[model samples]
Target: MADHEEDDLRMALRMSLQHSPPEAKRSKPRENAGVPTVSASPEESPEVKRRELMAAAAEKRMLMSKSVAASKPEKSADVAVAENSVLIVKDENRVLGGTVSEKPEAVCKEEEMKDVNFGEELPAADANQLFSMIFGNGVSRDILAQWSNQGIRFSSDPETAMGLVQHEGGPCGVLATLQAFVLKYLLFFPDELGKFTPNMPSQNLGSRRLSESECVTSGDFASLTEDGKASALVRSMVEILFLCGSKKRAVIATFSVLCQGAEEQSEDGQKDEIFAKTLEGLPIESASDLQKVLRVNTCTSQMSAFQQLKEMLPVFQSRLGAMLFLISALLSRGLEFVQADRDDPSPPLVTAPFGHASQEIVNLLLCGKAVPNVFDGRMDLGGGMFLKGIPTSVEVGFLTLLEYHNLCKVGQHLKCPKWPIWVVGSESHYTVLFAFDTSVQDENELEQWESQIRKSFDGQDQSGGGGFISVEGLHQVLRETGINLPPEKLDHLCSTGFIVWSEFWQILLELDKSLGGMKDSTGLMGKKQFDLFHFNGIAKSVLNGSQAISGVESPLQRPRLSILRVSVPPRWTPEEFMADIVVPPGPGGNDPSGKDTVVEVTKPEPSQHAPLVDCIRTRWPRSICNWVGDPPSIV
Candidate 1:
C-alpha cells in the first residue's frame, strides 16, 4: 500500500510541475542570460500583476499540500495520529516559506542528550605572533634585534602574560604593561626623565596645558644611545613585561622584588629597615600565599596596607620609592584586578597590532585592569571585584600612539588630563609629553556649536538627509530661517554644489564671531547664573525704562513695586514648558513693532540659547517673557 501511495504522489507532483506557470517554474541560468524575462504585460497595473503572482504562488502551495496529503498510506490509529501532527507542523512551516527538513523537538532533545566534551583546551598562542600583535610592524627591526642581543625573549604564552584577554581591544595588555612601567619610571627618576615633566609648575598647575618644550616626541627615544639610562630603563621594562604574563605572576613578581630589595637594604642598615621588618615572613611565591600572610581580602585591609606603604615612602629617599609606589597601587586594587573579560570561543591568536586602545586599557591605567567600559568606574564584575573609573583630573595617564596619528578617539579622562601630562607611546618606544597652557586641553565650543548646527540642517533637509542637502535646498532653508548669506559666501560653502554638514560647520566657524570665542563658562557662573542673569536684566529694564504700567499715566508717577516674582506650577517640567508654552500672534498675525517675534511655533528646533531657556524654566519657572520660533534667525 505504501509503494502504491508513493507512485501516486510522484505522478501528482510531475503533473503539477508540468502545468505550473512559466514564472513559477524553476530553471537553471544560461551563459548568455541577458534576456529580460517578462513578468507581466506592460498594460497591466502593478496591483493586478501583484495579485496574479500571489495567486500563482498560492496555487503551487495548494497543489503540493494536496499531493502530500494524498501520499499518506494506511496506518494504525496511534501511528496515523502522530504522522498527522508532524504533517500539520510541516504544512505550517511550508506556508511560512521556511525550511521543511528542520529537526523536530524530539530529535533536538536526543541530540542534546549525547555526550559532549566541555573540557577541551584551546591551542597555546605563538610567542612571536603575540609580540607582533602588541608592538605592530611599525617598530624598527633594529629594536627587536637589540632586545634579542640583551637576552630579552618573548613569552611562550603571551595570552597568559596578558592576563584576561579582551576580544575587541587588541594588545591592551602590552599597553597596560607599558603604562605601569612609565608610571614607575616617573616616580623613580622624575628629574632624570628628560622626555616628560613629573609635575607641572605651580603657576600652571590647574590649567591642564602642555607646552611645546615640555612635549616628548619619538625623536627623544630614537635619539637614545645604546647604553644610556633611558635605554636601560626601556630594556628593564620590556624584561619585566615578558616575565609577568598573568595577574598572579605580576603580583608575585612585584612583592618578590620589593622583598628582595628590602632584605638587601636591611643588612646595610638603610632607611628601609622598617619596611623590611614589615615584610619579615610574608610569602612572595603566589597571590594566594601573599594574600593569606597579609590578610588583604577586604577593602579596609587593603586600605590599611596601602596607608602603611604610603607612610614608608618618606623613608625611601632612593629608587625604592618607585617600587613601594607600584606595590601600593597593586595592593589597593588587589591581585585579580587586572584581568579583563574574555570572549566566548577565544581566538587562537591576536593578529591586530597595538593601535587604538580599548576602554579596558584606559581603565587599567586610570584605575586598574582593562574594565569593560569608560563610565565613572562603578561597575561590579561579580566576585567582589568592582572596577573604578579614571578620575576627572588625573596626575598621570597614558596617551596612545594612534591619537597622535589621528587614527583613534581618546576618552575625555586621558584627553583633558589634570596635569596635562601623558605617557605617550610610539611604535617601539615610550616617552613623556606635557603642556604648560590649557589651550591644548580646552574643549572647542565652536566645534560643538557646529555639531548643533549640523543637526538643524539634518532636521530641515528635504532633498537628502544625514546632514546633507542640495545647494538649492540649503539656500531655501537659510532664507526661510532669516539668514541672508552673500553669494560669494554661499558659493564657497557649496563649492561642490552640495551642502556637507562638516564643511558647512567649518565655514560657519570661520564666519561666525559669537561662536568663535565661546568657552565653557559654566565654572565661572554657578548653576543658576543664567536664570539669575535673565531675572536681573528684566528687573533693571523695568526699573530704568521710560515705559509705564498699564493703569499708570507716567513712568515715575506711581511708587514702583519693591519685589518682582515669577512663578510656574510645580507640575510643569522644562520639557513640558517648552512643548506647552504658546505666544499669541501679535495684533493681526504680524509684528508691526518690527522686533523679532514668533507668529506660531511650527517645530521645536534646537537653539543655541536652549540651555539658557531651559535653565530659566527649571530654576525660575514662568520667568521667560518671550519665545523664539523654530529655525531661529541669525539677526
Candidate 2:
C-alpha cells in the first residue's frame, strides 16, 4: 500500500469507529480522524517513505483490531454492517462513496445497497435484448423464413394438423396418408385391432360397432391380443417414429397403413375394400386449412358440421390424441438423445396440439431439455406464467431461438473436442453439423467454395462439373440446389472450439468498453420474449425529446425521411389493376367516356397483333427497402 492510501484507510477506519455506538468506539489518540498519516517528513528518502507507510499500516491495523475486539458484540455487528459506509480515500486520491468501497474486504457491505438500488431503478435484463445486443438483426425473421420456406409447420394451426393427417407422398404426405390408413385398418380389420379404441367415453358414443372380424381375441373387450397383425402394426408405428424422428405417432401410424398395405394385400379381398371405403372419401385438411377449422364462427354450414363433429367424434379424438402423444414422447426423447450423444445431428421432432395441454406439452419438452428458442420465436419471458417453463431448460433462456442455438456454435460445442458441434438450420436452410477438420485446411468452407468456383470459371469449363460458373453464381446455385454436406463432415468442420462468423467477439468488445467508469445497466433477472425491431421503434419515440450525447454515436441508424411522387399512366382507369393494356375507343362516335358510339373511320386500321403487346409501364416511385449495416462495398 502507498503511504497516502494507508493514511486514508486509517483515517476512514477511525472516523467510522468514532461514529459507531459509544461502546464500540476505540479509545485512541486522534481516533476521530478520517485518515491516518505517517509521522514522516516530506523530504524523506523513497525507501524511508515506504517504511513509514508500512509502519503506519501496521499500527492502524493493530489499533482497529483491538478496538473491534473490545467493542461489545452487538455494537461490533452494527459497525460491520455499515463498514462499507466509511468514505475511504482511493489510491487515485479520490474519496469513495458510502455506497462504494476501495478495499476488497468491504465488498459485502457495499453490495447490499447496490443491489437494492439497482433492482429498484432498472428493469431486469431480458434474454431478447441480450441476444440482440450480441447477434445483430433479423435472427427471428430468418428462422421463421426458413421454416415457412421449407413447409415445416410447427402445428401453429389446425390446418397444419389436418395436413399431417392427409399428406400422401413426402414425410408430411406419408404422415397424412398413414392417418387415413390407420382409420381404414381399424374399421376393416377390427378383429386384429384391440385396445386402440378399447372403450369410448359414454358421452362421445356414436352408436357404431365393428363386425366380428374386427374384434381381435375379444374377451374383456378392452385388451387386444398382442399376437395379432394389429399388434404388429402398432409396433411398426413406433419404429417408424424412431427412424423418421417424427413426434406425431398418429401420423406415423397412418403412414404405416399405407406402407404396409403395399406389401400386405389380403387374399380374401378384405384390405382393399376397407381402404377404399374409409380413406378415399375422407375429408382431410392441409396445414393452411387447419386454422379455418379452429374458428369460433362459421360462414359455411360444413364448418358448423365439423365443429359439431369435434364434440360428437370420440373415435377421432381418441385416435388423434394417442397419435399426438406418441409424437410428443418421441420429440421429447429425441431432444434428450440429441443432447446426450454429442455425435448425433438428426433433425429434431416437432409436436403441437391445440388448447391448454399444448402448454403442458411445451413444459414437458423443455423439462426434457429441448431448446425452445430452437426455432426463431422469442421466449415470452414477461408476465406469462405459461412461459416460465419454456426458458428454464435451455442453455440460453428467454432469448430468440437463433440466439440460443448460436450459443452452441461449432466452436462452443467443440470446446474440448469431446463434444461435437450442435445441429442448426431449418428445412429451407440445409441443416448441417460443424466441426474442425485437417483435410478442410481453411477455417471457412464458404471461402473454399468461392475459390473453387473462381478457379473453375477461369479454367473455362475444364473442371469435372463442367461449365464456367462464377463465384457468386456458385453460391446462388448451391443455395438453390439445396444440396447439403454429409453429417460427418459438418461435425468434423466444427470440432474446433472457435467461431469465425459469429458475433460473440462483438459482445466481448462492448463489455470491455463499458467496464471503465461507465457501467452497463442492461441485464435481466428472468426470461422474456421480445422483438427488437419493434422495441427499436418504441425507443425512437421515447427518445424524441432527449438531448444527443456529445461525441457519442447514436445506437440507432437514422432513416432517411422523404416524400415520393408517383405518375399514373394515361388512359388507365383508377380502378384498373393495370392501365397500360387498355383498348382504344373504335373509330369514333361519342367517346366511350360514357356516350353512344358512332363510327368515324378516321382512326388508322388496328394492327392484327396490337392487343398482344399493349405494354404499360407503371411507376412504383415510393418503394422503400429498409436495411441494416454499412453501405454495400463496391468490391
Candidate 3:
C-alpha cells in the first residue's frame, strides 16, 4: 500500500513538472549519460565558450606538433618534404636570377673533340680537298675512288700534256664531233656536277679576275666569297677536254690508245697499221675538210665503220667517238639535241651512213661545237653547242684555256662583253672570238659597230623579251592535273614574260613532273588509248550476247580516227550491252590465266571486208543467250 502511494506521488510530480510554465523550462539542464548536467550562470556564459577555448588549445597543440615534425627528418616523408622545399627555392632563385646551370667543362671538351676531330688527316688533292671542305673525308674518299675508275689520266709532267688524252684514228670529222660533245659537257658541268671539285692552281687567270664595273652591273661580284664559284671552275678544263657526253664517244676517241700494244705508235709502225685497218671499218670512210690531219683513207675504204662501232662495247672501251657513232646508227638512240625523222618517237634502228650522210647532217652533227654555250645566268644551254666527237691535240689545250677564261667571267659576274672569247677549230683557220655575243647583227656591219651595239641598251632589251609565262600560271595548270602545292617551287626554271613557245612548252613539261606524286597515277596518253581499245572490245563482246564471243577492238586502236567515226554504231550502249550478256564459268582457280571465272571465247576473226562491228563480234559463249534484261545506257 505504501509503495502504491509513492508511485502515485511520483506520477503526480511528473504531471506537475509537465504542467510547469515556459520560464521554468528555459532554465532546465540536460542530462549527461544517466546523470543530470550542471549549468553555468548567465553572466559567465554557456559551455560553448569553454569548448571554444578547449578547441583553441587543441589547435595550438596540433600546430606545435606540425612545427616539430617539419623541423626534423625522422622518416622518408620528412626527407622528401625537405628536398621539395629545396627544389622550390632553387626554381624561384633560377627564375629571379635569369641564369642557367652550366654544363661541366669536361662535357664541353668532349663535344668539341667529337665535332672537330683535329687528329684526322686532310685531303691530298684539291678535288678531294673541296669535298672535304663540304662533307667529311668519307665521301671525299669515295668520290676519289670513282674518279680513278673514270680512266682519265692526270699527269704533272710537262712532256705528257699533249698525250694526256688518247687519240683514236678514224674520220677527223668524227673527232670534231666528239670534241663538240666534250664542249657540251664542259659548258654544262658547272650546273650538272656537285661537290666533286678537281685540282686547280690558286692563280686563276682567264675568267675569275673579271670585274662588275667593266660589265655595267650593279653589285660587287668580285667581293663575293669564292667557295661556290671557285668550286665550280676548279680543274674543270681537263675533265671537259677528256670526257664526252657518253662513254661510247670517250671510248671511240681513245680507241687507238686502248689498242696500243705498250710501245709508242710513232716508234712502231705495226700498231699504226692495225689502227688504220680498224679505222677502215668505221662509219667515217673518208676524211672531212677538217679531218685532213687524221689521213683516214678517203678514196678506197668501203667497210662500214658504223657497223664496227655497234659491235664494240664492254668488249672494248676505246675510241668512244667511233663506238658512239656506230651505236647511234645501229641502236638509233638519235642525238639528244637532234631529232630522228622516224614516225616512232623512241630510239631508232641503226642506219650507218657509210660516209654517205649529207653535209647538212654533218653540220647538224657538229653545229655549235665550235662555240661554248652562253648561259644567260639561267642554267639552260640557250645556244646549241656543236660538240664533235673527235678532239685534236691542240683543241684540248684550247678548251683548257677557255675554261679558265669563262670561270673568271662567271665568278666575277662579268656581263655580256667580258664574256669568254673562245677559240674553236675548223677546216682551215681557227675562229677565235674576243667577245661572244648572241644578238642578231647585220653581217655587213663593222667590228666597231658591233662593239657599240653590245654596250648599248639594245643588247639589254635583247636578253629575254618575248611571249612570257609566270610560275603562278603554271601552278594553276598543275592544279588541273591534281597536284596541290603551297610553296609551288619551279625547279631549275625561272619566270619570264617573254619565253618562246618551245621554251614555254618545256617549262610546262617540267612542272608536270611534280604531278607524278599525285594520288592518281600519271599514265601515258598511249596507255589511255590502249585501255579504251580494250574496254570497247569487252563491250562489243557483251553486246553480242554470247559467252564465248570475241571482243571488238576500239576504233582508238586503229591508225585512222575516221574508222572510229564511221564504224562504231551511234546507237551502241555499253551498259545495255553488258546487261544483255551472260558470262560463263572459266577454268579452275589453279589455272595461270587469271582469278576471274570467265569463259573462254573463240579468237576474233580479223576480216577486212566485214564491218568492224561484225569483225569484233565474231565469237561468244552460249551462256549470254539468256541475259535479256535492259539497262540504262551512257552510250
> Comparing candidate 1 with candidate 3, which one achieves the higher TM-score?
1
lDDT of each: 0.34, 0.26, 0.25
- TM-score of model 1 (CA atoms): 0.30
Q: Model 3, residue 377: what's the lDDT? A: 27
Model 1 has a clash total of 10
lDDT of 1 by residue, 79-192 (tens): 322321121121111211111221221111111212211111111232233333223344544332222111111112211221111122223333334433443333333344
In candidate 3, position 21 carries an lDDT of 15
lDDT of 2 by residue, 443-492 (tens): 23233333453453344333455433333443343354343434453343
Per lDDT, the best of the predicted structures is 1
Query: TM-score of every model?
Result: 0.30, 0.17, 0.19
Candidate 1: Cα lDDT at 428: 32
Q: Sorted by lDDT, highest first, which candidate order results?
A: 1, 2, 3
| Ranking of predictions according to TM-score | 1, 3, 2
Model 1 residue 213 CA deviation (Å) reads: 23
The reply for model 1, stretches above 4 Å from the true place, is 1-307, 314-331, 340-363, 371-396, 402-413, 416-419, 427-429, 436-439, 444-449, 462-464, 469-484, 487-635
Q: How many clashes in each candidate?
A: 10, 45, 56
